[model samples]
Target: MTVVNGYEQSDAEKKLNILNLPSLADEAKKIIPTGGYGYIVGGSEDEWTLAENTKAFNHAQIVHKALSNIDSPDLSTNFLGIDLKTPIMMAPTAAQGLAHSQGEKDTARGVAAVGGLMAQSTYSSTSIADTAAAGNGAPQLFQLYMSKDWDFNKSLLDEAKKAGVKGIILTVDATVDGYREEDIINNFQFPIPMPNLEKYSAGDGKGKGIGEIYASAAQKISEDDVRRIAEYTDLPVIVKGVQSPEDALRAIGAGAAAIYVSNHGGRQLNGGPASFDVLPAIAKAVNKRVPIIFDSGVRRGSHAFKALAAGADLVAFGRPVIYGLALGGAEGVQSVFEQIDHELEIIMQLAGTKTIADVKHAPLTHFNYAD
Candidate 1:
């Protein structure tokens, strides 16, 4: 039987027959409608950063050692006190319903099945309570976009706390929405009846929708404010979307439990450096004070390994998870996880490593970039 990305051909249907990352993305585009397809794949403006996010991974090469008696590698690790079977979490990407009918619920289920964690976006189609219920008490975090109305954000925080989310990931990069040319061209919008924000709406159609409400209500999230928010909640505060060491240091100074180094999957700030490109410096600045979680352009397990060797405590993915959801809902998401996890296991065995801790701080070199 032909094996593709660790899944056998006989098991193709069970594995979504997704083959590899490129095929998975193509299949997703084929399954989703045109507007949603564009929104899912297109990056901001020139999309240089989107391209770079993946390219930066290509520039770094993972060096593998072959002569060790490692038959099985342990992938388990602890992130902010949550025991994860693998050091992978689903990055908080909004509007999952655009990909599949079940949306965040399906993604959460898939994460739970794999014993991984997920950070739910504030713009999710489902309400926090419903999503928590659907997640069935799986370890989860709530990603926050501070609103112009302090009352609204505070109330949302209260809801997340009550819903039993383990942590709060405060996204600070997207003060304004990125110039998503595809979103404009396709006229893409989040589905109406956003369960999470329904209670906050004026109730008379005074605004366009929740998206508009979010746009108008979003206030600039400051580093100082990050500290205040951490104080407001007993749950851990993780600051996501940080791309610089200085900002990372500031987040750490502000009592952040972790620093999530990301370029918003290259969906925001088209010309910005790739998340991988900026990771080393941020890792250097962080210097183990706080755990560093990374995302952006992690399509394969090799990318995850490279990020780990370079200094990421945990690696996350957004687009691939959405692609999986688009193809076969929760099962597809599980297949994607299985593929990556399988590949990671193989890499660890071949590299003479026996665990997630063994993968970190390995010597990595760049292959094709001219300095």
Candidate 2:
């Protein structure tokens, strides 16, 4: 066995083939426990938004240009003043310990290995300092769920600053738990300790349902809260879970340095519009006021390319990374990113785009579809 990011990887895991990002979930399902797997993959209610998130990408087709001297297209870009080797980033997912023993620590190391960014969730299984140490100075963002207690929020922000986090992602949409029927069917409960929340938790929540824990969070989140967190942290605050143009503008007005366009991976709202479907309007509304980060059903390189054309400064994903962690620990996670990065390079070269900026201006044809 070899130790990676403080987790032991067996010889078999080291040799696991993880070339495909979408297929990793199947391999992971075999290893992760039933309840954990359900929680990771299941979406809210009917999962209509979940299915539509990836399907929406099909509606926007890239208009490939011919005869451009583009060889080895560059995928590197800067977001919120941080340089990245690839525009691809990891979205903040909670309770990573359900996927791997090392959890966010392994994820940080994998993202660092590939020169990518990771947003550690406020409810992460590992503490901020440990996750930062595992990254060894890789650019990272701390995603805040915003607890009901002001003292807890202040303490969390202080820890993030001490850990050298590059930014703060304030998630605002999931004030309550979505009706995830899969969890209901399987009677799922968070199995591992959320080190980040342990200090603030009122009591041992090992037996609490996801809904009960979510109920404890502050539900009356507003623009003032955004400004408060940004002012407190003194870091770039990214408002995550934004899907509307009006909400995008409101977040910016409330002192958000960046706007994250996501629908909680269709995990929060069941009947909502696909995150990609709403990107163009939000992008137009924001009009470059701040950087825009997008996630939700972004599975392929072509998907990322389309999102860039539609108006995303950076593209991120959550489930695939977890699956990678479940399959091969940090190395598996690195392979998932490497595969997408390689595919993106190929798509960029073929599409005659030499840089990420070129992709933004690349023409796209939208196909009409019935809602």
Worst 10 residues of 2 by lDDT: 6-15
Best by TM-score: 2
lDDT of 1 by residue, 143-223 (tens): 987777677778889999999999899988887767888877866654334565666642221223333645644556777
- lDDT for residue 316 in candidate 1, whole number 0-100: 96
lDDT of 2 at 86: 94
C-alpha lDDT score of every prediction, in listed order: 0.80, 0.88
Count steric clashes of candidate 2: 0
Candidate 2 lands at a TM-score of 0.95
- Candidate 2: misplaced stretches above 4 Å? 1-16, 202-205, 369-371
The TM-score values for the models, in the order shown, are 0.91, 0.95
